[model samples]
Target: MTVIIFTVSVLCLLPQEVLARWACVRACPPSCTCTQEKSCSVLCDRSGLAELPKEFPCEASAINLDKNRLKFLSERAFGTLPSLKSLSLDHNNISFITPGAFKGLSNLVELKMAHNEYISYLHTRTFTGVKKLVHLDLSDCNLFSIPDRIFIEQTALKELLCFQNNFRRIPGAIRGMENLTHIYLERNKIEAVAYNSLLGLGSLKYLNLQENRINVIHEQAFQDLTRLENLYLNDNLLSDLPKLAFKGLSRLKMLNLGGNQLTNLSKTWFSDQVELEVLYLDRNQLLYIEEGTFENLTSLITLHLNSNNLTTLPFPVFQPIYFLGRLYLFRNPWECDCSLEWLKEWMENYKLVRDIPCASPSSVAGLDLGEVVFAKVNGTCVDPADLNLTTASSEITSTTENRFKSLIFTLIHPEFGDQMGNGTESLRNGTLIESEDGQLSAGVTGQRAWPSESLFCFIVMWLSLGLIGQSDLFFSLYCT
Candidate 1:
């Protein structure tokens, strides 16, 4: 009797198992292609799907509905897909998502809804139940703001991509995201970085804010991002930065501040950036840099100060950066006078020092600054402290005829003449000229000016000085 009862129990369970297999096979929608290997995957991409398919494999782990016409996602749209780990709805017209649309996707790890231009707003509880989401992409969307509690349940989220959006400010919804490590918010319209903008995001390692319109950053704006490694704020409208703008980012490795309107730098801006490796300050309006401005950046390996209005830098400004391997000082008006004699000596030890052209003092104008400095030094290592601290005019006043010739050269040189003509035009029009690097220069009218009568005499004197042989040197200097 016991054997007969056991046999009957086995017969009843076998039919139920077969029915479960049949149900899995019959659940796949006709418009979608389903595969059931280790786990089910559905691909309904580009099938003109206006709405979510009514039936999906019960054990479906991934779904791709990209390039569809889905406009709205109703509540419980993906009902109870406990095994769903990934979903892609990119390039769709999804305008609205109900509060509980992802309610039953408890195991979802990645969700992509990028390029949905109509999603300008979201409900507070839009992501109510997808607690295990680790990566989310909302790039190229029309989101101007995000509800503060929209990501409240996404505790495991690690990376968030929201680039090419219409946000005017950093979203406050990312306040408590402790596990978030990377954030891509480039190409947005963010105006300012407010205080405590990243309050609880201590784990954030990379933050990108390039190509924005950020003009102000609060002192404590990045106090909570102590572990951040890379921070990009390039291509902004920042004219000045607070002394403590980057207060708590001690572990930061790279900081990009290129393409801005800064006229000067404060010594205290990088006081805490001990681990910084690369720094970009090119394409600004900096006229001079103080001695102690880079005192704390001992580990800096690369520095960019090109495309600025700098005429001279203070002595020993870069003596603190011991590990510097690459230094870019091109595209600036560097007056290679006695004050800059130290740069030539410094360049000898580092072959990575880029060629810099002198912009003034007609004798060396348009010549490689390194060559001029080498010629002036003449194989003698002059002590910087012992050198005379007189003006370039006083040093070259051995004869009255030479002084008159220098004055004529300054007035007739094409470089200075063109500069004066443009400056006059800018003064008349009251507009700044856009430079080749896309930064605004004060007096660059992009027009050439005719040389004065003194140019003929200056050219005759130059030809008589037997300096024609240096033409190859000048060409090679720039070409190299």
Candidate 2:
């Protein structure tokens, strides 16, 4: 009877053990650890995972397989994880992805495939079943090119990061992504942007093309990108731009053109950009800008013109840009002189002006223009015409005063006055003490009628008026 009880107990314990092992296998994947609280979240990251587990929990919502040794993604790589919304395969050794690799992952929303150095190409149908994917990151993948229409089925994709690649030019078919709102393509090898290159990207708002070799941008390059707001083109090889290069970007707000080779800007370049707010032109070779080049950009809030070869800008160039809130003019070879008087006043009144330290005319070099007095910069010819008039009048007055003094000295001297031959004499008060016939010099043969008497009064009036400027003040004080 005891042996019979032991056998029955053993059978019960064996079934319980088997059931416990089955439960453990169902709850967690062999190659990954599932969170107990969520029941469907798995973390297979950095586990030396060479490939997707033979079976993943059907209810898993997130799978993080980043920093793994996965090399290839064959068809049905994840085996139809219907509930998976986010999958991270970043920092993996993924080299090839079969066309149907992501089949049946219709619920997947975000996928990260960055830092996969061996990935150079992608098949056109690689994302065939991942129609609901919203954000895709394929940056730093050593990609040289991609098949056209590779992203056509990703209708819901909003943000795409494919920077730090070797693409020689933007794939023309990328313009078909009408649902995309942001695209990052910086640190690439794109050399030029052809007209209508971004034709169908109507919903795009931000684009980054910085750190590229973009040397040319054809007119209407952004033809249909009407809704684009922020554009970055800094750190490129661009030296010039077509007049209508930004023709259709009416809603653009911020533009970065720093670290380029631009030498000049045209007046109509910004004609259609009515909503531009910030502009950067620093680190260029700009020597001049056409007058009224920024007239249409009246809404500009910030402008950077630093680190260039600009010596001066025309007075009217900034007339229409009256709403500027921030201005940067540092590191340019500014020729501080009378011509900069208006600029100095503008900068002082704007209050948000940055370093405008003079870079030329050694007298004011390294000095902040906003602090220098306008009168000193303009020198004596603040108003050229007025200065010339004042100088001419001064010379005439000096000559007349000298002539009057000589006449008065001759008449007042005892020796010269009586020896006037016809006799002409005057006292300190112009009383005319002697005449031609010894009667106070009325009118004589060789003398004068007291030199018209008015001459003495004129001299006396001038002296009393005290109109002698500094240059003649000393002479008048002692002579008079």
Candidate 3:
């Protein structure tokens, strides 16, 4: 570990805190229990140290000054440590840091500055002497930012953990770390990412970007990382997957985009990823699945898609999954209708397994679409005594249609009295009088009268005619 200091103006007015720090740095005992190999790897850990140890003889390689009531890091407190590699300053109350405080360290490897108080505006050359630095972690630090020249001299950095920060934009200096391969920027306030920020080194392989407020990414932001593999961009406000966002990557395998505002996934979303294998799209507001969405992902094996709103799986939804073996469709509010008839044959005919487990919203929970939802759903009932064609019979469809027509008239025209029957010469022989209507109405068609009105009027007319004849005879008898 080497001393890292911002080589700016030196402190001229030494406060009492600085006076105490200098006293400890030069006059500490030759040996202590908390220090090892010229470094206090576990010192000042809430152990009888009300204030920070001002002086640590430059023999310690690593120090643990966390969970202390230290209120400041006086200039040169850690400025001259020639052998320090790692430092723990977590859980501290030190808010003030003089410029050039850590000016001479050139071998620092890991630095933890989590859980601290306001330290904004990292002056340029803040890490002046630390040239072999690697694994710099500032997670949970009350830091607004480091200067654009923070990683100016150190290039051996491989992993950076900076999640839970206040970064609102992609750090333009990130492209300077050519050897960096893994980056953790999750759970942050980032809103946008620029492609040009990652223009060099091309060595990033794993990117953890979960739980961010990101809504946009330049199409070419990831064009340089040829070896990139796993990408996690879940829990975002993305509505669509840009076509050129992953333009140059050829080795990407797993992509997690589960929590987003994507409404539909079409082939245009995956037109470039020919090597994608595992795709997780859970907890999204997707409404449609376009067949072409997976056309280029011929190597896909596992697809997780639960907790969505879907009415039916269209025929084209399953067209591209020829080699698919596992599918998860539970937790989705599926509206089963006449369209469900296709799912049964869709599984058996396509040799797909019919094992689906229901998730929340108990309305459709624990029920299998093919075996339970469809098999026992309200089915058609057959009228055994029906003179019309039955559903059980394979008779001509036209016959069934005609029978349905007759049933409709019989059931709807109840005033027709005996009008419900087939009315064939054989069926009606004992009923309605033939040629009851004036126009020789063979049947209830255009020339025939309506069943209800015609029957009622004809009956009245017949009764009146009979009364007229009787009245004439009665009058004659009276006259005699």
Compared with the true structure, model 1 gives a TM-score of 0.73
lDDT of 3 at 136: 75
Worst 10 residues of 3 by lDDT: 3-12
- Models 1 onward score TM values of 0.73, 0.73, 0.65
* Candidate 3 lDDT (Cα, 0 to 1): 0.61
lDDT of candidate 2? 0.77
lDDT tens readout by residue for model 2, 48-80 = 888777666556778899999999998877766
Instruction: List candidate 1 stretches off by more than 4 Å.
Output: 1-27, 36-39, 373-480
* 1-480 per-residue lDDT for model 1 (tens digits): 557445433433465456355444456777888887777789899999898886556567899999999999999787666778999999999999988988878899999999999999889998888999999999999999898888988999999999999999999889979999999999999999999688999999999999999999988789999999999999999999998988888999999999999998888889889999999999988887777889999889999999999988766787798448898999998877766777776777667886788886666778876777433356664332223333343443333234235435444343454344433321222123444665433322353222332344344445443343342233223211
lDDT of 1 at 197: 81
Better of 2 and 3 by lDDT: 2
Of the candidates numbered 1 and 2, which has the greater TM-score value? Answer: 2
Q: Higher TM-score: candidate 2 or 3?
A: 2
Error of 1 at 347 (Å): 3.2
| Model 2 TM | 0.73
